[model samples]
Target: MKNTLIVLSLLGSALFADAAKPNIILMMADDLGYGDTGFNGNTIIQTPHLDQMAKDGIKLTHFYAGNSVCSPTRGTFLTGRHHHRYGIWTANVGHLPKQEITLASMLKEQGYTTGHFGKWHLGTLDKVISSKGAKRKPAENFAPPWQRDYDRSFVTESAVNTWNPGAGNRAKNNPFYENGKALDPDDPTLAGGAARVVVDRAVPFMEQAVKDGKPFLSVVWFHAPHEDIEAGPDYLKMYEEHGEGAHYYGCITELDEQVGRIRAKVEELGISDNTLIFFCSDNGPEGKTPAKRRQGVTSGLRGRKRDLYDGGVRVPALACWPGKLAAGTESDVPLSTLDYFPTLGNLTGYEMPDARPIDGQNIWPILAGEMDQREKAIPFIRGNEVSLVDGEFKLLLPKGELYDLSKDWSEENNVAAAHPERVERMSREIAELLESFKTSHAGADYNDPEFKPVGKWKNVGSKKK
Candidate 1:
């Protein structure tokens, strides 16, 4: 406890000393698993850079993505509200609602430049169907990054190849658009590994922000190891002995290298002391088995991808803000990507322009070691699966199973019968939250007293099935 108090005191001072609109870079991996990196104890995958990154800063042991999938999780990260409140139920199911305020829009109000790189599955990049007979039809859910408050963006509507992103049929259908202009497929800038291609765009954006002497928010979401997973010859050769695992493992290693690249760039630009660099996957790995090309292991956790279990949402997370965060520290404080907005907002002293139910609480206190247990329960909903990790107990509805995550990380034992009172209380709390989410989705959150010109909430999910 002595060491904890000392770390907390130092972190508090550091946070204040560098809290004046410091640069922020949020990096996310596309379907990376908890057991995929060396820091998380995977011996086969070579992630030296990521391992060193954990040593250099705080490693989050129990971090969670906002959802078990990409699109909804992205929405939560940007808006600090449940995606259900905005009608994003699942992947490729909805677009970002214009009525919702994003982190980009928030930071932009504070005079920060914002840029988004890599897969933007929140909406379509091309609104009109290509006359050339591309696979993507006229996008009914058309919401591009440029339209969503990003100053400069190089993004795709959805997934592309892990390598040679621009040269494929997928590229023809859903191409990378820079500030609303689709790039030529043969553009030389679209070459090399997917992670590298993303970082290549991100680095210049940060440099220019520095050159302009403005604090920046650079969101780099890599598509490596997601689907159509491939790696360059060098990366494949590194994991050749793993058989089919080579493609999956190699793509991740390539992704790790780019993570190191971003860290190195921040240091090179002399912004290491003020810039916050965070890393995590959008969700847990894809596929049920670690066979064939989809070899994302969840470190012995229960479900994969779509399930509302630890393996589906719990992810490997690392945060490095040199001179502010303590080195070689670990926190099991059940954090979610939902906390990004509130945390950054508090750090920068930016308040929401209007009153709304922001599901994410400010977690700087948790990160600074002032607190351990989360005050607000992290809730999740996918289709009919509803669960909320409240303190140590996670209550899964419909299934009616309760697991004390503090004791059973694998969710092997159910203690609902033993703790009937606890289960009853938590269930009531979840029901209240779901009802609140329903009200928010129906356009109650917008049309503030100031009469801001916000769009009406469109029910994207109604058109889904």
Candidate 2:
């Protein structure tokens, strides 16, 4: 009887361990460059919290966003598929389709409370009151976070002033919308730092989930240092050498402080061990005249925001899950935001719908240090631009430039003529992937036969098919 009781106790412990699911918090910086933080060897900025997070987490050395731009990469984060597959080809081009499944919808099935805090450029926030010079969605094109399966949402339609988000644009604007209504313009709770207000809304939602004894997914996408950058006087004093660019550098430090707050909240709630936190940028720095004044750095990497070179798509990525992922560990394996859906799906036992194809693979094994490389190569497309990276060799087509990333990290050498065979192989791969993407974009992925385009163009590519 003594032996039988001991065996039963051990079995119970194992079962309970398997039942616990990690809370997921995904944070992304707005137009943050590759070498902007200390983790990536930046000497100019003092991002103590982000630097500490890197020291305590698993650093992904070659991680990439879905696209070189904002909206497309966000689409990839939710669906774990290419953005072109669902019609969000460019920033503010369309909304996330009702037919497509999202990570929030998947987590909801498994009883996880989900919240989205920060930028929501997936579609229009309201039928009226659009920000000037900002892309506005038509009444029919309206798709907000509530419509996208997020349980609780605090978001803005697009970029806003980092210091004064409520004022000083072409039109009188209050972009911070809660649930489904806009927040009061004079809401003093969000008067100071925009990043602080974003985290303020997020932490409460997380605390409520813990009180309810439930798992959660919190998305914190800060609008810091995006455009019209301005930092508080205290933060501005931190970087006086940059002059007018002080706002740009100081705002990043402010955002880092909120990161520390969120980290502390998890510890205060005693959920740090059972929670997974991932941080990255939406894309590279904005390339227009905004970048000229923003003073962002790309770590000596060539190309900026809208281009597919390593500088544009590659952003700083870090993952932390105490007692799960080892501290201070780093890997150079290439990864994309597209892998999030399949990875989380495997963790929570969520089976993907069979009617469509999923571009992302199960990367949980890679995260746990079981594998060094991905099972499939990541493919990218934005307008006429396309790129295919298989381990060290990278193919950037239209120009057909080939670079061995292992040897030439900056992509300065044009080795296409040296290795014609490799170029031919990658070229064939891009063509096949493009055809598949075209089929998916034309409504073949869903059961709806009468689906239609939601925005400006049917297909906006630099080169015609």
Candidate 3:
């Protein structure tokens, strides 16, 4: 009887251990320039929270978003597959398709409580239609409700209003809200615009998850420093003291403060050691043109948000899970948003559905310090333009601009003329890969004809846009 009781007690302990899994919080910044953070060598802006997070966690120096824009990158992050695979080529002001599997849905299968706060550009249900009270339109390219796949979600159906200077759209009748509660947009006590709203919602969600003793996955996507740069009086005044760089610098500081709040809350709940936090930007900076008068830089990379260049696609990424990832470690291996699905699956021991073809690979070994090699080349496409990076040699096709990324991170020089053999081999590889892509919709055809050859296979050199 003594031996039997001891065996039963051990079995109970094993079951309890199996029930506990790490909570995940993914935060994405909108239009955050690569050089805007202190760790990335930004002299003007102050991001103490992010800088500290980098110091306490693993920093990904060579992280690349799935796309150079907003909606597509989010799509890739959630699905762990290339955005183009699901017809999400760009931010077309619509929803994701119903058939595609998302991270939230997969997590839900494993008894995880999933919630998405902030920008949900993926799709909306008919009940939360964007048309106020009017009859629903023909749905157009909108994603069906099935695609959203979240237990609880709050998202802006349109571009968030960050343009209204002193008063940043957080009124009682503000369009950005969930369940009829107006989000605090210009609250001096909170962060700025959309970030303020996300933080407020996220705090309570984290509290509730701890109470319920369930592993939670929350995605907070902030719409700040995107456009119409709006900074509150106090934040604006702080930057103004620093002279000409106030407006841009102030917004970043406000964002950092909000992140600090969330971090503090996680610690307050005594879950900092068990929680995993992933922070990154959807893409590079926007509003760099003269007409916009935007004060931002791409850290010396070429092109802006819309272009398929490094400035557009490359972004800062950091991950922290106390006691799991080594503090202050930095990984220079190229990583993409698509890898999140398999990595999470491996970590939690949840079986990801294998119904469809997934382009991303599991990076668990890399994060666990067991492996150092990234075996596959990342493929990128925007309209007719395509690019493939095999290690340091990035072959930009049709235009056939080859840049040794190891030496030229800015993409200023075109060495395709110098390496014809390399260009030809990469072009043929891209051609064979493109053949496998299923282009069922005419969306790819509805692009600016001028940009068509940008991703094509050809040999051109010494050109400027």
* TM-score for each model: 0.92, 0.92, 0.82
- lDDT for each residue of candidate 2 in 1-465, tens digit (9 for 90 to 100): 334433443443343347687799999998899888989998888888888888888888889999998899999998988888877888877778887789899998889999999988887778765553344544655788998888999998888778766654611554688999897766777677789989989999999999999999999999876886789899889887778778888899999999999999999999999898999998888754333357777887778788899888999889998877888989898898998887777767676667587887666556667667776678877667789888888888787899998898899998999999998998888777777777887878887878875443343323555
Candidate 1: pairs in clash: none
Q: Rate the local accuracy (lDDT) of all candidates.
A: 0.85, 0.82, 0.68
Per-candidate count of clashing residue pairs (backbone under 3 Å): 0, 1, 6
Model 3: colliding residue pairs:
385-455, 386-455, 397-456, 398-456, 398-457, 398-458
**lDDT of each residue in 1-465, candidate 1, tens digit only:** 446544554564455655568899998998999999999999999999999999999999999999999889999999999998877888876678777888999999989999999988887776674312343333656778998999999998778888888876667667778889988888888888988888888999999999999999999999977987888899889999988889899999999999999989999999999998899999989998898889999999999888789999999999888877889999999999999988888777776788899998777777766788777889998777788998888988877899999999899999999999998898888888888887887778987444322124432211233
Please tell me which model should have the higher TM-score, number 2 or number 3: 2
Q: How far is 240's C-alpha from truth in model 2 (Å)?
A: 1.6
Q: Listing every candidate in turn, what is its Cα RMSD in Å to the true structure after a full C-alpha superposition? A: 4.4, 5.7, 8.6
Q: What would the TM-score be for candidate 1 when compared with the true structure?
A: 0.92
Which of the numbered candidates is closest to the native, going by highest lDDT? 1
Q: List ranges where model 3 is wrong by over 4 Å.
A: 1-19, 124-138, 141-147, 163-174, 179-192, 241-245, 289-293, 439-465
Off by over 4 Å in 1: 1-19, 130-139, 448-465
* Cα deviation of 230, candidate 3, in Å: 0.3
